[model samples]
Target: MTTAIDDPRRTGYAAEVVANTLLDLARAEGRQLTQMQVHKLVFIAHGFTLALLGRPLMYNTVHAWKNGPVVRRLWQHWGERGTRPIDAPLPVSAGEPDVGSDAEAMEVIRSVWNAYGGMDGVELSRLTHTRGSPWSQVYGQSADLIPNEITREYYTGLARSA
Candidate 1:
């Protein structure tokens, strides 16, 4: 009875497997997920995996909140005790220790990336400014420095080729 739908090797069947599994789980738990919710879950799960694997975790904590259940489950199952909270809010400020120099700012970036599940440098810069951090203030004062790390050149090239 190996119909196309039953053939796990096929892309369509593989997708069906995942879809059925999710639907079955949702039905069993009496939970429903919208398309947007599912997209957010996939995005955050990818980000979390990248982070744990030492890849550049490029997403925002708001995205993390969208995937809170997955993060909570991962933490509970694998993460160390006290490493993170079961229901933690995203960090809004650079607490306590002052970032004094570029070196310090880089460290802040790393910590923010780790804590917030990563954000684009521009977004991170904006968030720091929003929180009234000294680094953000200094960066805001400087008109020369480009906030985005991805670089205008790369974007320009892509746009030109397109």
Candidate 2:
């Protein structure tokens, strides 16, 4: 009886899997992801994946939080680590399965990690908070779903220009 709705650990989506992968990447670099770092990186990963694959990397919602893009769920877990430097890293598994068949999404995540992982939290936040950025467009709104369209278009343009 492994119903999709009933399985809290596996939602048949790539979010947790991607989180695990990103955390592993963070660990390798001796970086402890702050809440902002976790959110921005995950959002960027989704943006690149949506740009390349026409689908979101994570099944979770991306919100234009006051700071920047945020995944509320992952935010909480990382938030618990507080604003202190060298906060404990989230577990690699974090109770979710690997992204079984979504290698393309993983590649995008890896690309994002490689390109942006070295950046500081403030820098990542600034990138996402840029004027005309999706987060800027919905900075204070309640229904802050970071638009898939904007994300795709922006990241696609970035990829092309890069």
Candidate 3:
């Protein structure tokens, strides 16, 4: 039985689907990304999706960690890679529904890649850590979750300004 979390129409694509798509884009450009870079890119793309399209990008939870916004599932899945560039795609686990079918989502990921793909993880982290950024607002506070509403509002402001 598929729940709302697993249904792309209800929530969003699986984080791995998003991550794998990002990795694929990087590979096509002859680039690579550390786990940190992957996480940040995913979060950034998600934020933009929420703001611009008024929809979520991934079902995964994003937490304001010390480094920056992090998708917890991605953190654990790619943690073993450390600072090394991830060279391969994430294999879809058994029983997991195949996704990445949303054209709008793919376009958003592609746009994010074209915009921020060149920067390394450190640079991306610095961008997300900037004052008034979604991560900056809730980080170090009693709460950890970087609410989607906050992300949408912040990114919406950014879009309007840009």
Q: 1-162, model 1: which lDDT tens digit per residue? A: 657543322211111122223333444545543333322232332223333333222222221221121223223333443322223222223321222222422342343334533333234334333332222323424332222222223223333554
> Which pairs clash in model 3?
none
Which segments of candidate 3 are over 4 A away from where they belong? Answer: 1-7, 95-99
Worst 10 contiguous positions by lDDT, candidate 3: 92-101
Instruction: Write the candidate numbers in order of decreasing TM-score.
Output: 3, 2, 1
- What C-alpha lDDT do the candidate models reach, one value each? 0.30, 0.73, 0.87
Instruction: Assess candidate 3 and give its TM-score to the true structure.
Output: 0.90
**What is the per-residue lDDT of model 2 for residues 54-123, given as tens digits with 9 covering 90 to 100?**
7767678888877778887787665655555544544545445566446776688888998999888899
Model 1: which ten-residue window has the lowest total lDDT? 9-18
lDDT tens readout by residue for model 3, 78-147: 7767688887888766655444667777788888999999999899999999899999999999989999
lDDT measured at residue 28 in model 2 versus the true structure, 0 to 100: 83
The residue ranges of model 1 lying beyond 4 angstroms of the native Cα positions read 1-24, 54-162
Error of 1 at 130 (Å): 12
Tell me the deviation in Å of residue 30 in model 1.
Answer: 1.2
TM-score of every candidate: 0.24, 0.79, 0.90
Model 1 clash pairs?
none
